[model samples]
Target chain A: MNQPYSSALLENAVNEFAKLPGIGRKTALRLVLHLLRQEELSVENFGNAIIKLRKEIKYCHVCHNISDSDTCSLCSDPNRDDSIICVVENIKEVMVIENTHQFKGRYHVLGGVISPMDGIGPSDLEIDSLVKRVSEGGIQEIILALSATMEGDTTNFYIFRKLAPHNIKISILARGVSVGDELEYTDEITLGRSIINRMPFNETFKP
Target chain B: MNQPYSSALLENAVNEFAKLPGIGRKTALRLVLHLLRQEELSVENFGNAIIKLRKEIKYCHVCHNISDSDTCSLCSDPNRDDSIICVVENIKEVMVIENTHQFKGRYHVLGGVISPMDGIGPSDLEIDSLVKRVSEGGIQEIILALSATMEGDTTNFYIFRKLAPHNIKISILARGVSVGDELEYTDEITLGRSIINRMPFNETFKP
Candidate 1:
């Protein structure tokens, strides 16, 4: 009886959703109230979006990147340079690299990186698939476009080691990317330069 | 014919929307790509929500707050004290005041204040309706819960002068809210205390 203005149900839902990354309680309340102020069609739509996002969306079977279908359109593309595969940390990175219009190479998304602190390790990454893909031949060069981080380096080394025996030319997207900065945060020019100045990982980058 | 990446249309839309106020491009892309990744129901739902929000929601006639109906529930609530109307800058402020549970009074939402630089004036506010509401009344008091800024003070003075002819008990929310601070950022406890210990501005609080 002493409730201030509205339903607790609405407040509870807002509080629950406000816990998402980059969302504050105030912003969450704003979104929730915005939704509440809408017609039932909007409310139903919001709920369906949340539910469908959680249930329907899945990673592409081949690349492990987010996709509406099993094999992503990039993986199925016949024109993309299949002889060169550029590896990235996330699907978001894949888009960033693609937006530059420089690289026509295919992308391999690692789902995540190898960080023992975050409980991510070699087995956790898709290093085996990278190795298998390179061994299967047509791949002439494998470029590592991972972020400049301790964990990103660790993951890169693990992939490098796994592909060492393969006949493909192995290279890492250049060094000017300072440590602690994410690849996603880098501008397109810098990312492009890093890709163009790729170096062979013989020793320093070996796992 | 020359797009290299998988879902170019969805990717571009995600990046554009992410640049908005609170949504980062990653989250924006995540949301847009999430829609692309979903079945038809989810995508349609997201579109429907945006449309319903724009079309179905309208300002309540009495409180001038968002609602599906003519009058907000607060204005129609029989238990709410109609004689005491607390005036606030925006609907967000209304929620803050309501969260305090201290005021059992009705509300008059001004929409915004008299900022001549931004080209807003008294006529732009719901001041005329407030004057009419105060004029027709069993009203004992009109509490001003405006922000303690230059523009807020200006708006308060304008309202005070308009409602003064009615010879009603007119008070403003305290200066306890520090100089150059918005009403929204003030905590509930501080805001509630400011309301309870309000000051009567007759001639001294003017420009």
Candidate 2:
């Protein structure tokens, strides 16, 4: 239903908010109304924050991850292993992996997976830069940390084939039932993969 | 968990987005990233729309509804009934009632209900303006179209008492089972009220 937004300004704000991914018109109205209720300075800050970020934000020249500088912090950090790079779909994956604190390597954000349905091909991603990074020769291993979807697998295989000539160790993320997941609730494909890729119990069972 | 946002600009934008009602950090990150993926001009438009709205929006002098001018469209319309006024909690309710195409009368937005928990007193709303409007002598009816919650009921009663001295006909939105609702699935109070306030068959029956 068309919202009877009495004010053109309110309508414009609501329309702009609705354009965001997953936000419906009703939700956009609610969000706009909530913003209206806020202090003018706070709302200004909210708008300015978005504008400023978009206007001035940079991507790492080395990894293509979002950064304030030419090179991202992770890529610049001397403590992180320069010999290993974790290749992922986007910066969100970098944050997720960092939160786990399990990976202490650099990241290479592909921007997105090679999805044919969405018309996102290999050229659209940072695959060429990734190949160039590997060809430069300090990297000993590449971790394919993309999502386990068909597009992710396709991207992973494409990267693997491109980097095969370099004689570097390339590995995809281990597929298994999640640590806290119940066996009964685990899907067939994941359960099957977990069984097939089972490691020695001693490696996982820490006393 | 702390997000390892490589850029402070990105982090600030995410923080601002997360401050919005119902938006969490992850969702904020996703939205911010989506904006980042859009064309620079589109992202600028999104930000500018919000800023422009907050900076320029005006409230109607007569009805307190959001408007571009001193008087709202509904209040200024010559065809709308001037004798009756629909008292609503906010502009959203006004829009909802208007969308129904039922109320030809103008609206008086209270801005909010009397909620002691939220520290919102009757004085905090546009109740004084409503009283002042009724005291001016042309209004014949006041329809309290507020929500059905205890706070709504309390506000309705308060408004009724306030408008009692003005000698105007006071009414409220009917509380009953909703249209298209199954009897078995309806709440006890609504079902009971529906039965108690059962209307004449001919009045409601179309076929």
Candidate 3:
């Protein structure tokens, strides 16, 4: 019950699986055993997937988002608003914004936020490329769509200061109650901000 | 933000990861991305582990437990009892009994229990090999240590009928209140059985 039987190959597979983030030895054992029962072709395909992902995947040169090619689909799109670039911390954030179908602009992935504890600074991000993209002309608005954390704020301010000299209008996502959020269950800080920054009754209905 | 960029290779990797037992689409993406961030050499090692597991692993011919060789460590050991065999559902159960260090007998893994609903019958298990092992004549006692489920009972009874003519002592694990189990929390059937089959107070203190 506590330990499965001894087999060098089984142990090797379990150890490899356990190396993944958040996976424990028990879960790794379970996963390996499950794979062991599958067809050899399927198991080999699973292995090849990981190997290919590491060896072949490349980041989009324009936005720094993970892609199979040098440039991502969004960056190469002719109809998208290249003038309004949405800045985010990672590629996942790009997906989040894309799901809303609200913004029809390109994106700039910072790779990560500036966290001193994690030794991440302004240089670690793609801020210089963003500034260069703006200075090339025709760019009118840039959206700071990072999270509401301290690191997000620090990164936003750092990019704002760098872009100020280029004379481009910069804006941020509005903070308020979520669309389906109930006031009673909402946290104190978010509820307070939503009340303090309450929009006009007519403005709420306009959108 | 919900839909990550479309890439055939990336989607293939994510789909392969999602095929694992407990993993979902979101978790598969996280795992694939985590592997992507690791060094290429390390990811290759992870992939190779699965390939090696599928290509090289073998099961013990004597007991049906997974092994790196033809015969398992337990079967080859000269110190273990040859007459008494502890019957179990799988290698995990063998490990459980081994951890106790109380039963010094050899084990015979049935591979699985008889389940008509799942299309697993007596033929699916290594029952013929087990009967052959018993007929060879050195087995003095056989302990049935399958789970306390309906399937377990059916398998046990079926095995009992097959081995009846062999004239070997057969026994089942005692069903009673589990150690450290509270009477109030214990199920009604188990409690009643425990009361009816109570061991002598002096016998309880012995081994």
Candidate 4:
């Protein structure tokens, strides 16, 4: 239904909210109305937060991850391993990996994978910078922690080929049933891969 | 899970977005990322629209609906019936009624209903203004078009008693099965009410 918003200002705000992903006009209206009820300073702070982030946000010069300074905190931290680099698609993946606390290596954010369907190529990503980082030498291992999708596989293969001549170890995330998944419910490919790449019984069993 | 956002700016924006109703941290991150991908000018416009709206929006002095000016377009329009007023809970109800293309009378927005559970009373709403408007004379009828909840009924009764002194005709919206609702699926209370308040066959029948 066409909303006859009594105020043009209200309509404009709603339109702006509706432009966001997954927010429709009805929900946009609800969000706008909620904001309208808030204290003016709080709403101003909300608006300014978004504007300031877009205007002043920086990217890590080394890894291409979003950063507050020229070099991101993750890349500059002395405790993180400088010899191994974990490669991922974007800043979000970096956050997820960091939360896991399993990988202590520095990150190499590719920005995005090679998805030709969306017209994204290797040049569109930070692949050249990744190669440069590897060529500069000290990184002994490159961990390719990308998605399990076809595009992720294609990108992983491409990156592997590019870094192959450098004679460094290249690895991808292990493909297997999730920790809590029932063996009967596991997909054939994952189950097969889990068997093929199975660890020795003594290594996995503590008892 | 704790998100280790690489940039403070990104984290701040996501936190602000997460403050909105129904939006969680993960969804907030997605929205903030989406905004980051947009052009600087567009993102600025998004921020400016919300700020400008909150900073500049006005309320109609007569009807209390959100307006660009002191007098809303609906209250100022000469074509609408000045003798009748439709009392609604908020601006959204006014839009819903307007979209139906049925009501041509002026509207009085109550801002909210009398919900003692929420600490809202008659004084908290525009009920006093509504009573004052009626006491000033010229209004022949007042239609109570609030929600179909207990709070709505209580507010309607309160307003009915307040307007009883003014001696104007007071009415309410018809409660019945929805237009497309099946009789079997309709609740007993609604079915009973529809039966008790059944309309004259000829008055409702166009054919």
Candidate 5:
């Protein structure tokens, strides 16, 4: 919809809302109007939360995941497998893998993957910290649990080369049809790879 | 996805964002994470916009429309016809009509429609103020431009009864197949009504 002339304050609020990903002018207007109808205290609280998040939120010094304190809860928890670190593209991926309850290891968020097209490289990520963590020793393995994209491959390869000298075992997430997917609908590339890398029947049955 | 635990500050921001009309936990997390990646100054500006919007915004005394001051630009404009008032359910409708540039009159925002299920009544809206505006004796016409819903109809009837005593010229927004709509795909009721109330070809071409 064409922008209608309104009060400057309303316009400003709408413009800020429109800046959010996936929000357009119409949705922004609706959101701003909804906020206008809300109680002043609630709106203030909403604003304060965002402000406090940016002002006081910190990153885990050990893994670079977002945290309330110096170290993330997972990093500080001794029960988690610190010796087995899962390297991921971002904090969201860390959360995604953590939800599966499959891996009990700690994480190292690269902040982003290597995408030279986007001006992102190994230096732009937390590769040096990951290498340092391996150099410090006692790290049994480093799992390159990144997405199966060009950038993900680039990041995985870069990290692999760096950890090769340390003689640390490196692994990438297995490529396969996702759980609950129909075999008929599964992509051919993934199906072929999964078959080629098929584990022993007893080993698969153990899980 | 099951919620992966994160910082309390991050959770608070996500919770606040989730309070919006259609935002869910996942989308809220995405928005909060996006804000987290932004510059501190930009996030602060976003927060301040909401705070300032709630703190400084006011309603126009005459029409109950949202305004930066007691009197809105529409209400105070000398070029607008004060004699013709457009009664709408909310500020959004006012903007919608204003965007069409089809009305050169002032507006009366009812804030919301009368809905017993929602516990909203004529008293809860700006009905009393609208009656007062009509009773003051300058208004010649009132265009009831509300949604075509039960609550909208109820509010229109209620307002119509209130203004009956003032004997002002009352009208309603035209209901038909929307402009640029395909007749075959239009709802039956609207299409039937449009045909029954069809205007002359010359009259339709005038605009």
Candidate 6:
């Protein structure tokens, strides 16, 4: 029964495809089967592309983003703002914000956030490079567009402490209840500049 | 904006990823980013898998199905009925029938059909090997398990004509109303077969 069909090469291909998110064993098998069905040319294209990816792509040292070469285009751009830097936990977030067409400032991808429980502290991130960039003294403000989560707040605070001596204006996205009427996922707040503005949390609190 | 992300390497990676069915530019970007996020060891494993897929994997000469080595396991099997060949248009269909465990016969993967519109004729298919196998004269049956489509029928008829000289009991999976479907989707005689056989379609028609 084992020898009736399904060679180990096909099995290995299925296993590799199943490692991808949202792909189940049946789908993985289907994909591998599709690859097997193709003529030599299509299969060759798939194989060659993957090899090219590994051989050619590298990291942008300045922004710590995935790139084809040493310096990323964003870092090399002369028209981009040097004064304002948008700090994000992941390069994924940078793309998301960029899609909104709202942020004109350049980015500083931190690689990851400060999650001590996950064994990812500030040192594990690209925080040192960020500090060095700010310390060079031309940067005016740092906008933290990190998710409104505990780890994001922690990383934001850590960056704030490191940047305070440099006399830079720090900003975070404003938070109140969201516009969409949905069930609240979180009430955890860090109250960055919001505390200074002073909102009454308790309904019965006297003026 | 065009030059904002420049690299033949990155472009090639994205282009290759984007070529996959249903994958878009955004998703391709995300996949590349995910690869970049993985540790070097893990990325190496991914790359190695692709390399192995390209270099190590090859088609079995006998069945023309993908295999790691010379002959596919089915063609090499000792107990399977070499006399009874279940001919299929593609290797994917082989798994579909094999999963039923009913088929104890060997297979002749046709590679593809006789689609004149697509410039694929009987000569393009593995019909020559099949004729040679038949001409050698030990084989008993060739079950034409091609799809119910027009091209499949055309290919099956052509093979039947070629195989007319040989004495073989030719049978096909009985046409029937597909399981778990409404009566409306059924054509009359196919529905008749469902009522007549009445066991599961996979149980009997399979193998």
List candidate 6 stretches off by more than 4 Å: A1-6, A29-57, A98-102, A115-119, A148-154, A157-167, A173-207, B1-7, B39-45, B48-58, B116-119, B177-193, B196-207
Worst 10 residues of 6 chain A by lDDT: A186-195
Q: Candidate 2, residue A173: CA error in Å?
A: 1.0
Candidate number 6, chain A TM-score = 0.81
The residue-by-residue lDDT of candidate 1 on B1-207, one tens digit each, is 122345544444554444345776667666664455456664554444444555555677877865556787788889989889999988778888888777899999998889999999899899999998887879999999998778998998999999888988988865566667799998887788778867777843665
* Per-model TM against the reference: 0.67, 0.97, 0.94, 0.97, 0.96, 0.76
How good is chain A of candidate 3, measured by TM-score? Answer: 0.94
- Report chain B TM per candidate: 0.75, 0.97, 0.93, 0.97, 0.95, 0.84
Q: What value does the lDDT take at residue B108 in candidate 3? A: 92
Q: What pairs collide in candidate 3?
A: A95-B1, A95-B2, A96-B1, A96-B2, A97-B1, A98-B1, A99-B1
lDDT of 2 by residue, A1-207 (tens): 968889999999999999999999999999999998889999999999999999999999999999999988998998999999999999999999999989998999999999999999999999999999999989999999999999999999999999999999999999999989999999999999988998998998654
Model 1: DockQ vs. true structure: 0.15
Clashes of 5: 0
Q: Residue A45 CA error for candidate 5 (Å)?
A: 1.5
User: How does model 4 fare in lDDT?
Assistant: 0.95
The deviation in Å at residue A120 for candidate 5 is 0.7
| Maximum-DockQ candidate | 4
- Write model 6 residue lDDT over B1-207, tens digit each, in one string: 222244567667677667666677777777776765556566566555655665567677877766677888877879888888899977778887888887898888898889999999999999999888888887888899999878998998999989887877777766767768899878887788668877765776653
Each candidate: what lDDT? 0.73, 0.93, 0.89, 0.95, 0.91, 0.76
Residues A1-207, model 3: lDDT tens digits: 356466888888888999999899888988988888899999999999889888999899988888888998888889998789999998778877888888999899998899999999889889999998898898999999999999999999999999999888999999988889888899999888988988888887754
Question: Predictions ranked by TM-score, top down?
Answer: 2, 4, 5, 3, 6, 1
RMSD of each: 8.5, 1.5, 2.0, 1.7, 1.5, 6.6
Q: Count clashing residue pairs in model 3.
A: 7
Off by over 4 Å in 3: A1-4, A205-207, B1-4
Question: What digit string (tens of lDDT, one per residue) describes model 4 on residues A10-67?
Answer: 9999999999999999999999999999999999999999999999999999998999
Candidate DockQ values, in order, are: 0.15, 0.86, 0.66, 0.88, 0.74, 0.24
Instruction: Give candidate 2's TM-score.
Output: 0.97
